[model samples]
Target chain A: MDSITPNEIDIVRASSSKINEIDFENLAFGNIFTDHMLMCDFRDGKWQKPTIKPYEPFLLDPSAKVFHYGQAIFEGMKAYKDESDDVWLFRPDENFRRFNASAKRMAMPEVPEDIFLGGLHEILKIEKEWVRKGKGNTLYIRPFMIAIGTGVIAAPSTQYRFMIILSPAKSYYSGEVKVIIAEHFSRAANGGIGAAKAAGNYSAQFYPTKLANDKGFQQIIWTDDATHTKLEEAGTMNVFFRINDTLFTAPTSERILDGVTRKSIISLAEREGIDIQVRSVLVAELVEAAKNGSLKEIFGAGTAAVVNPIVGFSYQDEYFELPKIENSVALKLKDKLTNIQYKLEEDTFGWTVKI
Target chain B: MDSITPNEIDIVRASSSKINEIDFENLAFGNIFTDHMLMCDFRDGKWQKPTIKPYEPFLLDPSAKVFHYGQAIFEGMKAYKDESDDVWLFRPDENFRRFNASAKRMAMPEVPEDIFLGGLHEILKIEKEWVRKGKGNTLYIRPFMIAIGTGVIAAPSTQYRFMIILSPAKSYYSGEVKVIIAEHFSRAANGGIGAAKAAGNYSAQFYPTKLANDKGFQQIIWTDDATHTKLEEAGTMNVFFRINDTLFTAPTSERILDGVTRKSIISLAEREGIDIQVRSVLVAELVEAAKNGSLKEIFGAGTAAVVNPIVGFSYQDEYFELPKIENSVALKLKDKLTNIQYKLEEDTFGWTVKI
Candidate 1:
């Protein structure tokens, strides 16, 4: 739990930049990366010195525990550049706390804040050029940790690697997203590692999501595994429902992630005086709301897409199309949140941190 | 789905074997590996050529999906050397089928039989010297697949790598194992990836197991997550209970693993005219039986420890010590199964296959 000073980090700059050969406007999400990345190793019950080096591949043994036992955790955040070319990180401390929580659940080492946050600050300063000066052009930050211990036994690893890799990204927009309510497959269990930002939780949804995709749906709204009645999560993000001008979202629990964007939206809605309910939304309740024409909108909130609006949803062989309306709460909240991130508006909540 | 002939495998033998340096008398389960290993890459919609080269570390991108999303699966099997120096495998086809099922569930590409089975056969032949002659000595085989696609996305990877690494080991023996019945933590959900040998499932049990270890117990007997009333699995293995004379085991469901050794034990017990019931064993029933002196035995069945007998278990904070009885079913079954595996007993079921 030792704190790492800024001087303790070793820096190795890339000789050349790939920025000139790239087109930032037309970029795929998480496809291209910044020139430099941060890495730190944990071994012998202690964290090693942090290093910011050129982004490249690293060596691992064939029997590394990460490859066999999946002891890994990750976080997703973004860095924004304002018109004055000042870089800002949106609620990075939240991600740092959640990352350690995930590490504890996965039985991995908890990264020191100085290494997690201070190393992030140092790396961002070195790669600030990758953050373009625009509201939509942000640098996606992926901080992940994996077990590097070389053994295949089903036990906690003694060695681990914490890394931060940056990718330039544009505003994410998935067209006309349609979702299906899950009846069988689930992303997590009761008293399981669902709330952690663990790697396994995401891949566990891929097969079910693929099945939904084959049926012309973009995502699945997962339900409680035991009864499959309570709606839990939308794809990998936290979901919200709008009924009769009121927003409803499930409270964070062991089965649902405490998403940063989700909490921000709840705070923004409360400040804006929008009627929002934090409770479990059952399937029957949603069906009844759709039938009575009270359901106005459905959206997912996460780091990748700050607010993703859903056009329709299928439930038990029945499809319900949400009515098109002006002044969507989802879009309004997204705009306000992004404005605060880009420093266009006053940071009333003090969520934005200048680099 | 193309078949790879023996000649299709490219072999690069190690210049010298490390067999001399390894003390065959004393070795850890997965710590020491043979000189050569098998590897094959999947890309551009098809698997490339398979290679058998010197065992060593390999490079991977920091953003590999396996590290970020846990898109990986693995199988554990062991190679046995009979008295005549002929190596044998026990029900490898079952492992092959299960491996692909795991691949399908994780949304990774299915490996062809040639690349999986054929590669193992080729590698075992080259490292045959590592397989010693004895019933307790074994060459543990680990076949695994991981997503090698470089992206920070949450979707399935288009690229993957399949490999086989052999580790020499003695018989696994954890002395006087005591277990705790799970009340909160769970290994799998009702509709989760518990049946597949997914890497994530193993790591999910580590934290809970560590908690049990701290209390002087070796492992946790996971119960149904929804109600925690039915016994599901023990550590990473399938659990069996004996009440009076009849043996009881929970049927394999979405929350339970369909273990190879577990099925073989069921078959062997039937052949020996031992009463065995495949149904859900309730926790309350087990406690009542323990109080009535009918709960005779509890054991775990898996590849690593073929038949791991539990000396005692704690349920609801009440410790229950099993009476030491002669003619223990667990040891009897373990001996019979090993005899058949080592070619000492008659191959009545035709389960063993020559490498």
Candidate 2:
């Protein structure tokens, strides 16, 4: 491999015409791809030039370490086309920092901020056509890195592949989700990888989530491993509950992901005088709140779906159905975030990055 | 994607011409390829026909869910060629069961028993030559499954690929290892993927182990998540400690893997008149044992290396360096195990299966 200088990224333009087959209105979460993709190779102790190339398949040996050992990490963010037909990313720098944080934990090389931001900016320029304007339409950008070396010794790989894939997405998760409080299984340990958005972090939850789904619950509200008493997070999304009138959520810890949307909600809730309390919410407290009808609302926050309200929950083999209230906090937060995303409201926090 | 029968799977043979180039010696772990590879697909709620094909790369779209979600599981075992040239697999059924167990936790499809064993038999027949003779030499077989669907949703993928790749090799990890007794970091939790050979389990440990490695330790002896007091398993191996002539190991739980080699050594130790204790060994207790000079030997048992003796261990800030003995249990167990593996001893235990 030839050494690639910073200025010589070799960003070849897309030769093929833009995608015209798929109707954007019916797009799912991560099915459609943009015309261009961003890539950078990590080898010989440094990251190479960030390249923007036409989206295509890259070659990999069957024995690639990532295929076997799962040395991989990823970040999920979206690019939205405003009503005035301009591209924007919501807190792109935060996404970049979180991506590297996940990389450090996964034992994969971290992408330099300059390289990460540069590649996303360059790719956004080329793949701007993929970003749609209407409500619930956006270009979902997935930034991921994988250990790509051919040698597999049940150890970490030497080389890696960093690539950004673009997908047109509507709702990341489907419908209003009902979750079960975990009494037997925990999502992460106090010293585990729950905070990072590594690919393996999600895969390990599939089985437990499936079991919960089989019991008619759509998700799991995972608690701490030492004691399954304090609520940490939903398997993917960060969860918040309304106890009486104060909005309460678990504080970010090693076992809980520091969600962008979760942070946004804290700021928005404070601005809206919602009396938000970012602290541990014990299951016993939740159960008590439920018994006294003080559990006003339960919601999940993430980039995919801004804020999704929970309808019900199960605990200790018993299910509790939640009442859907009009003008809920979830709906209000979703509107606020989406409005800022679509340039319908002034982004006072400067959360949106114009492309 | 046509329906495949058992006989059709057997019909595909290893290419006779290419078999000559394979060298049993000078083989790196997972670096040498066998003539034929074994494969089965999980779709529509069943594990369909097992096939044997020439070792080659198969195509997958870049958007395959496995690449994004890390929904993959794998197993490692070996096929030994005895002095009489008879092929043998050491407890392959155990590997199959573990593979499926990992699949269940990862939410990947379960592979049928008949197909799994049938595929192994067919692949071994074609690539029999890859199985080497002499002690510590055999065909290292890796059976793995990965979700292969082309969508990036955070849920389970509908499709999966179950495959077995063979590698000619010596020991996978070569060393008289040194490990750090974990104080702050942990590998698995109370309700985690530690019991399963899920890819995430391995990926989650890389960063923590790297930190330990930087401190001159070869591995980290992982502790239970609830309390960092008890010793669990080592990275890629199950551990055993000899304190005051009593063999002690942690009992297998939801947080510890049911390692095949660990079980084998336990059985072998009992047959050889070694006092064994299957119970938890707390860090403070072990440190005390080291202080009183009761910590005689520390060894790790796994299929890859058979027995790897630990030369030292580090706690919070204290370091315990073990002295080398003339003939320890580690060497004796390794010799006995490898002797049976090379067909130098009577197969009284019925652990070896002839193919």
Per residue, candidate 1 scores C-alpha lDDT tens digits across B224-337 of 889999999985689999999999999998888899999999999999999999999999999999999999999999998788999999988899999899999999999999
State the TM-score for model 1.
Answer: 0.99
Interface RMSD, all candidates in order, equals 0.6, 1.6
* CAPRI rating of model 2: medium
Clashing pairs in 2: none
Using lDDT as the measure, the top candidate is 1
Per-model TM against the reference: 0.99, 0.95
Range of the 10 consecutive residues with the lowest summed lDDT in candidate 2 chain B: B1-10
TM-score of chain B of 1: 0.98
User: What's the C-alpha lDDT at position B61 in model 1?
Assistant: 96
Q: lDDT tens string, model 2, A1-355?
A: 1123336666878778567887887877787788877788888888877777888777776677777888888888989989889999999888988998988888888787666776777777777888878878888888888888775577777788888888988887776688999988877876788888877788888889989888888899998888889988996789999877789999998999999999999999998888999899999999888988988899999887678899989899877777768778878988988899899999999999987
